[model samples]
Target: MTITELAKQWQTVIHHKPPIEKDPTSNDLLILIPGNPGLVNFYICYLDLIQQQFPNFEILCISHAGCDPNSYELFKFYGLKDQIVSKYEIIKKFVMDNEYSTKYNLYFLSHSVGCYINQRMVKLLLDDMSLVSHVDIKYVGLICPTIKDISKSVSGVRITKLFNYTPIITVLSILSSVLTRLLSDNYLLGIIEHYHIIKKPALVDFVSQLNYTNSTLGALNIVSKSHIVKQVLTLACEEMKLINEEKDINDWFFHDLGSKVKVWVYFADSDHWVNDKTRDELIKDYYDEDNHNNIRFELGKSDDGITHSFCIDKSVEFARITTNAIRRLN
Candidate 1:
């Protein structure tokens, strides 16, 4: 879809509209937040699917400014023109202001880098008294959250810091793109076919994993252009600076300062992006699993032993049912 069409669809799905006027009869509110400075299209598309399934719920999206001209140009370069993180904050503030006035169970479906942004927003809402009483944020659905240390997830992401050079990777990337494009029309056709398969809630995640891997190779080419590379570089630098400012990463991330929020941890059995042992360790260290008072950790597992991208797995039907069961808590 074109950028304008995507934005319009996003606004329709996220913002409170005439047809979707905040209904008092609705039992729950669904917030669909996307990851990174890019991915506006993916966020909206997923939200559209969920909105259809849960029409009564209010589905809102929070987009980060990582894809703007001054921010991250990854998406913009790919044709997503407007980078509007400011609009997301406005919606969040609105939710906060009236959070106490209404009573609705809250659900958050976040993807990729969006998971980090949602975590921060959830933290903020938990801290704010005005919003805490109005809604019960019962469940959070995360799709392949970016938990893998970049150094380990992708080969040279970390090494870039040490080398401060982009020649080798850049040349390889450009050459590869040329070769792939020249090989045959089959290459492009294959990509198009894969793109369609990814739309299914079951296949969405696996496709995402493949795309992420492919994109990393393509990303090297962008590094050759200072303006393009600056986006990733600046974000990385700022992220590190933020980490240094904080005493601990888990403390910064998993703090349950909000109203009785239960968490639904979704993962594929074979997901390489999410290190199962490490994630389990983090969960054990950060959250007191024994404390049933506020948190309930419902893990989504693939019976067939699937890999990291479990978001759109065919087995997600089970996962969604499990998620809905969590929502039925209060």
Candidate 2:
């Protein structure tokens, strides 16, 4: 089959059958949760790398409501999505029902905001340990996780925070979201600034090619043309308001860390988008890597030609590092 056809077939299988069930009887299953607005295509390259290295593993990729192109039909606006938290709750329920593993080791591959959801899920699991026994979730692979030390990381109104102001930021956020839906999944502006893919062979072209081949853009358009974007955008606006109003309150620091899971953070040495202070706090406060060796930090050297978006870069060396990490965890 052509690459495009194969991509579509894979999407079909994933949608129909949970990606997490790749190896139900296996010792461990890799669950990849995407960050921000993204499709499975975003991580296909990485998945390909993992498959080559460890051919005997099961891989499940979960695209959250706000992140999935298919969900855009249920949420069109994009900038004001409040149901994100609710969507995550649903995912939690799914995990509980399918593999409430006390013994089955679960490894996570998360990127950016995906880490936030993963942490939240871990907290929920910790709350009622009986709902799950053992909860053998270990080795979280976070690619530039967006767990911000709110006080230090978040500055004034970021371009994304436009959703906080209805007439100004909200309008722009909606416009950009829709424009991205219409123009291209890997559109240059969307790829670089918002998505932050700073790797070579022009990561934009690489992602764009995948989107085109995989029909990701088309599926996304289907959802965008529906009412999903509107609902999701409205939800985002509400969340933005919560964020804004809560700024005066200094309690947004991540208190979700527990001894249930181990973490492996992969971050660039210098990423302007994700502040260093925030990273330090995540290491110190959230994971307590300073005190605990369970959570390991691998600072990618930008000087050696790595950037913030190394997760999806086309560089062979970059691919090797990424695949090796997943293999080592396995």
How close is every model to the real structure, measured as TM-score? 0.57, 0.63
Q: What value of lDDT does candidate 2 attain over all alpha carbons?
A: 0.50
Output the lDDT of residue 228, model 2: 33
Candidate 2's displacement at residue 32, Å, is 1.7
TM-score of 1: 0.57
- Lowest summed lDDT across 10 adjacent residues in model 2 is found at 244-253
- Deviating ranges (above 4 Å) for candidate 1: 1-27, 43-53, 66-88, 93-105, 126-138, 147-150, 153-191, 194-249, 252-255, 287-289, 298-307, 310-322, 328-330
Model 1, residue 54: what's the lDDT?
56
Error of 1 at 142 (Å): 4.0
Residue range 209-300, candidate 1, lDDT tens digits? 54433343223333223333433444443333332212253455555432345555555455444455645765676556555445544455
How many residue pairs clash in each candidate at the backbone level?
Answer: 11, 24
Point out where model 2 deviates above 4 Å.
Answer: 1-25, 66-103, 133-135, 150-157, 160-260, 284-292, 304-306, 311-319, 326-330
Where does candidate 1 have its weakest 10-residue lDDT segment? 75-84
Query: What is the per-residue lDDT of model 2 for residues 1-330, given as tens digits with 9 covering 90 to 100?
Result: 432243232221132122432444555556676654445555666665565565544566655444433332333343312223433344344445554333546677777656655655544555655646544666677777665542233432363455444455345446656665677544533445444333234444654455333433423442333333443345333433433212221123222243334556787677644677667755654555342555556778756666654444433455577676765544
The true-versus-predicted C-alpha distance at residue 56 of model 2, in Å, is 3.1
